[model samples]
Target: MRKSVMTGVGVITAVVFTGGGFAAYNLWNGVTGGTRAAAAQPSTVATPAAKASAIKAPSAEAAAAGAKAFLAAWAKGDFEEAGRLTDRPEAAVAALTAFRTALTPTALTLTPTAERPQAGAPMTFRAEVGLPGAVRVWRYESAVAMVKTGDGGVVVHWDPTVVHPRLGAGKALAIRPVSSSVPSQVVDRKGRPVGAFPSIAAVLDQIEFADDGAQPAGDGTGVVVVGSAGGSGGSEPLFTISASKGAKRQLTLDADLQRVAEAVVKEQSGPASVVAVEPSTGHVLAFANNPAVGQNRAFGGATAPGSTMKVVTAAALLETGLTPDSPVPCPKNTNAGGRLVPNDFTDARLGYTFKDDFAQSCNTAFIEAAQLRLKAGSLPAVAKDVFGLGLVWKTGLSAFDTDIPVETNPEQIALAYVGQGRIRTNALAMASVSATVQSGTFRQPVLVPGKAQPMAARTLSATVLNQLRSMMQRTAQSGTAAKALGSISGAAAKTGTAEVGGQNPNSWITAYRGDLAVAVEVQAGGHGADAAAPAAAKLLQLGNSH
Candidate 1:
């Protein structure tokens, strides 16, 4: 009996030890290889198909509950909660934040409307936000769709406002009141008033903003008053002016030359504008419009400058100790920031001096000069501060803002050196540059003299200016600008043809003859010599005759 009891105890001991060993093995597996065990197991959870069939469609009450929770969270600044309620939690947080930032106490209120569940898809909810303090209440409607997740939670699949509203066509914001009074009289450098027709208010109404409820002044005499209709159905004049108080002076513009420029532009295309500025005093002598009178693009239209910007590049190079005699490699094509820089105008090319390159409008020559020879830093800043390429110059009568790309990348700088990329300037401003070069001092170009402040001071040295003048004269005498105004005595000019697709490209001729400096542009014209130079020559002759 004693022996039997010992045997039984031995067996029990073995069994206990084996059970403990098995438990220890499981604990070790759980710590080191839990992922493997989990992968090996066949999950009893339902598949996406099974879940779709098993889950009930969301009721209207549930959708409303979700929307209310979302809005409440949003109003309370609980972005996380709001996101949790919407399909796009991250986007929901961002949208709610943007709405909060934009909508002040004066802003509108948002209210949710209908809720519907798609048969096999997610549930959708709708809402509207109304603008209150505005003259007109602008309403923005939004919709959101929610879907069930595998984790028994809901996720938004479609936030229509977040996705579609940005893509949808919508009207621009209501027009605001004009800030300042329209200039009535444009006076000359001699203090003589320009010819009076109508105030800018009247002209803008006739041209661009008539339906905005601008009213002409009563009494039908000298000045015109612009008024807006008040809420009480009465016209409240926003501005008042006297027309006959200023002297009626005439511009130096030749009607015949202006018509010829218009004809050239029309022959090329409908979308074109021309500006002629006197380089001596920066007076805008002739401004012409193509596509008739309604399409006014002379001062406002912004197009890529192309190679015309090389003038600034040349100026920069000259300022940085590079003379016209500087030697630069005339590569057929060179890589600039991974882009191939090539000479576009001519096929027959050779080594060129800086002067020859500029007169002939060589792209690669300037690029090489700007990068390797000049070694000038910050071309865009120089263009802005020196050449005033992207400045908003107000001519007292009207104003246009220049658009230049503020990119600092190598590609942008390389392209900008050749007047490609996003460099843009109006004809008036371009004329100012020519005037600056001619006068040996930068003068703010103005339609009405003394109306604008005088230009600060001379930006370039007289020696550099003379060098540029000489090169420009050579350009007129034998280079690309030779055909147009070359034979005209005492004319120093530079012509540029900027490539714009499908059109003839923009042509420019800026020159100075004796005392008058002029700048002219022909949009979509074949070449500066063929199109813009003739107009410039005629205007120069007219100015000289006067």
Candidate 2:
């Protein structure tokens, strides 16, 4: 008898005797080549049809179960066990080991397709592979080819395609640093470069990936998977990866307004900041800081607001039955909790109205009004209840909201009334202050579109709203703000020069025109009319175009 070798896993070799053209059947293990069974009579040779019946094929269910077991083992990092479930154990082990070492995957999930496998067919599955700090999970579909074994069991048919559908023969998977050809970037609402406004660097740093799945720009040091494609033996990128640094994130800031604000603040020799907002929606148009690299004082610093605090003080007085025409005394110096408070200019007039006090920023008038008419907690109550100040403001980023603590000390209350002693605010807060007056309601400021915060429950009465607008208009028309904003029709503003224990005081101005509101602060930049008002005017001047 002569025997031919059938060299394969679980393959059997058949023995043929050349007598009478008949073949004797013998079952021998392909690996061991040991005889298993001899034909009983060694009769005629078996036909091709009969020989095919001798080998039993696995059922479709058996193939699916075997594929599932192999995937489970791979997902669990059990390369050895996974290899044992495959037809070629050594090759499977080597390839799987290489995949793990090269990819360093943090997570892996394999989901079988809804359709079950047919006999001797590939079992399709969805693969979601994850890497550490990757911008997103890499998703693809692959299949598990199954084969029947000699032991009446099914095993995975090993092929490079099982790991990745694109991984052909002689190809290996590897992760390399992402090429700088595609780096993450951000843009303003008008598609301008976000980095152009150096003052908003802090705001940009707080944002991450964009929701839209657009491709990233420029190259980066991020992670990526590179490999050979279609058995070409040439290196090519299979996947680009990165941390959640978005390719392109869009901000709510208007690029035109940002340019104007940056240019305005740049005119200051000392530290300066400005914030602009849309009164109708409370959307932040622009926020800029001079020198561009220091702390985000435009949105976070809580310095005293000087006479700008009178806006809230006036609201408190209006809430307590005082009208804009109500008589108020603005003496050269008045007693406030035994401390002498003086106005910017001595008022010798006998009967000045509440409108005069606000327009002229009379420190004595507001101090005496709060001391005589308002209760101990009235100022903070009004700030929180009506103006939305002193409340948690979710502006989609880090910001210091207004802080007006309830004061029982009459001395502190007197100072706080004129925006001095414990009244702390920033340009963002004061800009919203003007926005509330213009909108007749408190709309929380938002820098990101679709991130608007809940509005305050209380709204300003129409009477109080009209009075505040009229008083601010008068100030812009003839008072401290006239030189900077009076020429612009319908413009309204309030100017302040806050005492910060220095020869040069902090300049502050809050203004609104049409649907826009803005505030400016210049540290040690002299009076508000000279320093902050011009910056605020420029911000409003550009709003007409937007």
Best by TM-score: 2
How well does each candidate superpose onto the true structure, as a TM-score?
0.56, 0.62
lDDT of 1 at 135: 22
Against the true structure, candidate 2 has what lDDT?
A: 0.73
The residue-by-residue lDDT of candidate 2 on 1-546, one tens digit each, is: 111111111112232223222222333222222232321111122222222221455788787777777766665445556667776666666565555445545556666773458786788876666655554555678898877766666778777778777666545566554453323555776777665467865445454333355665545433232333422334445565552355666666788888899899899998999999888888888889887765788888889998888888898898788988999978898877778888777655448899988888888888887777889898888888877888888776678878898877778888998888888889999999999999898888887667747767688789888988999999999989999998988999899889987658999999999999999999998888989998898877777345
Clashing pairs in 1: 87-156, 279-517, 306-419
Q: Over the full model, what C-alpha lDDT does candidate 1 score relative to the true structure? A: 0.52
